[model samples]
Target: MLKGNREQELIELAQKMIQAKSYSGEEKQAAETIGEFCKANGFDDVIYDRYGNVIGIIKGNRPGPKVLFDGHIDTVPVSDESKWTQKPFAGEIVDGKLYGRGTSDMKGAVSAFTAAAKYFAEDTNRDFAGEILIAGVVHEECFEGIAAREISKNFKPDYVIIGEASQLNVKIGQRGRGEIVVETFGKPAHSANPEKGINAVYKMSKVINAIRDLVPTEHPVLGKGILELTDIKSAPYPGASVVPEYCRATYDRRLLVGETKESVIAPIRELLDKLMAEDSELKAKVSYAVGEEMCYTGNKIEGERFFPGWLYDQDEAWVQAVVKELNNAGFNPEITQYNFCTNGSHYAGEAGIKTLGIGPSRENLAHTVDEYIEIEQLTKVCECYYGVMKALLV
Candidate 1:
C-alpha cells in the first residue's frame, strides 16, 4: 500500500486535478498537469497526442504484452453549483474523503495510476518485460470513445485497463450506446389557418409514441437494451404565427452484444416508413446522429453516435491475472459491470482488444454534485495497479 509521503503525494496530485475545470472540450490545463506529473515522476517517455491526450510510457528491458492504463481528464460540467456544499474545485477532505469535481468520476483514478507508475519507476528491484502506458484522454464526457480511438491509432496495446469508477471492483464490460434522431418534415404555413399546412410536430408525436413502445433486445450479462427519448424540438422557434417546418426527436439507445448500428436503427426506420406510408401528408426520417468537433489540440474528429458494447470473458488470462493481483492485495475481488459507457467502447468494443476496468470510487457517484472518493481507496487502487502491472509484465 502507498504510505506516508507517497500517499500524500497521490492526494496532492488528485487535488491539483480537481482544481482544473477540464470539462469536455476544455481539457488543456488538466492534460498539462497530468503530463507534467508524469515527467516529474521519471516516466521514460511523455507525449501529447495530436488531439491533446497525455500519454506517459515506461519501457521495460524485455518485450512482453503492451498494457495501457486509460483515464479521461475531461468531466461533465457541474450542473447546479449552488447545490454543492463544498467548493467544487477545492478538493476539500471531509471524513477521509476527497471531495471535488472529477474526484470520484475519474481524477482520483488518474492520480492513482500515476502514483503506481511512479512507484514502479522508483523501485530498484522491479523487473518487467513489456510497456506500461498511462493515457489521460480528453472528450470522453462529450464523445465516449473517440479520443481513445485516436490514441489507439498511435499506441496500440495488447491489454487496456480503464480507470473509471468501479468501487475498487473489476468490471468486464458495459452496454454500448448510440444517439438517434427522428425527424418529421411538413409544409410551413401561417398559423392562422391550421388546415392549410401539415403539422410536423403533430406527426412527430406518433413517432415518439411508437419509439416508447419499442421492446429492446436482452443479454444475460449486459442485461436489456434501453431506449430513452432525451430531447425533442421543433424548428422556427419564437415564431409569431407560422407552422414549424420540421420536428426532431433525439434518443439515447443502450445496445447489447450482437446489436449493431443497423439493428439498433432498423426498428425506428421501419416505424417511420410505416407511418409515412399510412398518411401521404406525413413524412418522417430516422437516422443515427453524428458528432463533428475540434479537439483542444485542434484535431478534428467526426463519427456516428454509436458507441459499441463489449464483454471480456472472465476466464481470459489477462483478466484472471488482474483478479489474482486484486485478491492478493488483501481485497475480495468481485467481477462487476459498468452501467454506463467508457473508452472501452473503442478498445474492447470496436478494436476488439482485451480490456478490463478497476478503480477507486463508486460508479454511481460519477457525475453527481459534490463528488468524492475515499482517500484510503485511492491508495489501495494505486497498490493494485502497480501490482497488476508487475504481475502481467514480469
Candidate 2:
C-alpha cells in the first residue's frame, strides 16, 4: 500500500490536473501546468511544441535506451454540465474518487506519470541505464495519432509508455481507425416536376442501407472493425419545392490489425461504383483528415491514411521489464489491448518503436459525463510508474 502522505499527494495532483480545463484545441493551461511541474521538479529539460504538447525529460546519470511516458492532456468536450454532481473543472474528490472531465479519459495518467518522474529524479544519483521522458500531448481526440507523429520526428524513443486507462495493466496492441466519406450527386429539378429530377438523397439511402448490413472485420486482439455513420448533409437549402442536387455522408470506421484503409473503403466504394454504373452523375470518394484548419469554417478534411495498427510482443525485454516492475508493485498485471485507438499506433506502427499501454482507471469510463478515477488506483499507478522507471534506469 502507498503511504498515507504519498496517496494524498497523488490525489492532490490528480485534482490539480483535473481542475485545469484542457479541452482539445485549448490545452495551453494544462500544458503550462505540466511544464511548470517539470521545471520545478528539476527535469533536465522541459519543452512545448507549437501544437501545445508538453514534454519533460530526466536524463539518467548513466546512459542507455530512451523510454518515454506518453499521454494526452486534451479531453473530449463536456456537455450537460447540469448532469454532473460537481463542476467539471472543480477537481472534486468525493468518497475517494477524483471527479472531473479529464479524470478518467487521462489527466489522472498525466498526474501519475509526472509524480513518477519526480520520484525517479529524486533518486537520480543512483546508477541507471536509460533516459525517461514524460510527454503530455495535445489534439488526440480531434486528430488521432498526430501528437506522436510530430514527437517521433524530433524525440524518438526506444519504447513508449502510452498513459491511457488500462486499470494499471499492460496493453500490447490496439486496432487502427479511419474516416470515410461517401457522396451522391443528381440533377436538381422543381418538386412539382419530381419525375424529371433524380433525388440524390434517395440514392444515398440505398447505400446507407447496404452499409447497415455490412459486417465488421475480425481481429485477434482488436476484436472487430466497426463502421458508424456519423454525419450527413445535403447540398442547397432545404425548400418545400426543390429536389436536392447533392447528398454527402461521412463514416467513422475502426480497423483491425489485418484490415487496411483500402479494405475498409472498398465495400463502400463498391457501393458507389455500382451507383455510378447505373447513373454517371453519382460519385463518391474515401479519405482521412489533414492537418489544416480554416478560421471561419474549421473544416479539416481527411488528410492521409497513415495511422496504422501495431503490436508489441508481450515477451519482449521491454515488456518483460514492465511486467516485472508491475508484479513487484503488487499488481498481477495482465496483457491486454486497448479497444480504442491511441498514439501507440504511431510509435509502434509508423516509427517502429516498441510501445505498450499502461495506466490507471477502467477503460469504459473515458469520455463520459461524471468521469472520475479511483484515488487508491492512482496511488498504485504512481508506485507502478516509479517502479517501472527505477527498473529501467537502474
Candidate 3:
C-alpha cells in the first residue's frame, strides 16, 4: 500500500513538472527534477542518457526477466492559456482534478512511476525477479516510439510498460502512425495564355481526390489505417498572369496491423500511375521520405511516412500479469487499446519486445485545452504500477 504523503508527493511533483512546460524537444528541466527525486529516494543507478532520458534501476533480490516502466517527460504544447479553467501549469487540485499540461497525456504517469519507485524501495513485504527500471523518456508526442528505439540501444529488456493515458487499465496494443510526401511537376506558362503552361495544381487536385477515395485497411483491435493530407505547397507563381509549375503535398498516415510500407504506398502509387495512364500530360509522381528532425538534445529522429500499428494478445503473459495484478487490487482492469500512438508501437512493432500500457490518464484529454488528471487517478496509477511490478517481477 502507498502512503498518503507519498501520493501527495507524486501529485506535487507532477504539477511542478507540468509548470515547467517541457514540450516535446525540451524535457531537460523535468528530467533533472525526476533524476533528483530518484537519487534522493535512494534509487540505485539513477542515470540520464545522451537523449535526455532519466532512468533509475532497482535491483531485485533474485533473478528473472528485467521489467521496464517508461513514460515520456514531455508534454504537448498548451493552447490559449485563457481556454483553461485553471492556469495550465498550476497543478491545482480543483474538485479532485489536477489541472495542467501533460497531466493526463503523461506527466501523471511519470509521477505515478516515480511514486512506485519510492514504494518499491521502501516496501519489504514483496520480493521478486531481476530488476525494475523506471524510465522518464523524452519526445513521445511527436514521433510516438522514437524514445524506445533510442533508449533500447543501451538497456534491452524482456518486458516494457508504456505509461500513456490508459485510465489505469491495461492496454495490450495500439495503432501506428506514418508520414510521406507527394510531388507533381508541370510546365509553367503565362496565365494570359493558359495553353502555353501546364498547371501542376490542376493535376494535384485529381490526385488528392483519388487519395481521399482510397480507404485504408482495418483490424478488429487496432482499427483502420488513415491517410490525412497534412500539408500542401506550390512552387512557382499562381499570379493573375502566371501558372504554377510544381506542387507537393505531405501525408500523415496512421497504420494498423497488416499495414506495411508496401501496403501503404501501393494504393497511392497506383492512383498516380492510373492518372498518368489516363492522361499523358498528368505526370504526377509519388515519393516517400522520413522525418529526421533534430531536438534541443541533438537526438536526430526519423519518422516513417506511416506509423505501423501493432496488437498484443490479452492472454499473453505480459498482459495477463498486469491484468491479474489490477484485479487483485480491486481494479476491474478494462483491457483495451490506446486510440493514439505511444512508445508501445515501437517496442512491439520495431523492437519486438512484449509491451503493455497502464497509466493514470484518459487519452482524449491529451492535447486539449482541458488537459488534466484526477489526483486520485494519479495515486491509483501508482498502486497499479506497484501491483504490476510485484506480480511480474516475482
* Top candidate (TM-score): 1
Q: In model 2, which range of ten residues has the least summed lDDT? A: 293-302
Model 3 steric clash pairs = 176-307, 176-309, 177-306, 177-307, 178-305, 178-306, 178-307, 179-305, 179-306
Q: What is the lDDT of candidate 3?
A: 0.81
Q: For candidate 2, give the lDDT.
A: 0.79
Query: What TM-score quantifies how close candidate 2 is to the native fold?
Result: 0.92
Q: Rate the local accuracy (lDDT) of all candidates.
A: 0.88, 0.79, 0.81
Across 18-112, the per-residue lDDT of candidate 3 in tens digits comes to: 87778877888888888888888777788777678888888777778778899988887876888887888777888988888888878889888
- C-alpha RMSD (angstroms) for model 2: 2.8
In model 3, what lDDT does residue 224 have? 69
Model 1 misses residue 215 by how many Å? 2.2
Clashing pairs in 2: 128-393, 129-393, 288-302, 288-303, 289-302, 289-303, 290-303
Kindly state the number of residue pairs that clash in model 3: 9
Task: State the lDDT of candidate 1 residue by residue for 100-208, as single tens digits.
Answer: 9999889999999988987886783446788899999988887889989978889889889999988788899999899999999988899999789888899899888
Worst ten-residue run, lDDT, model 3? 120-129
Candidate 2 lDDT score at position 204 = 84
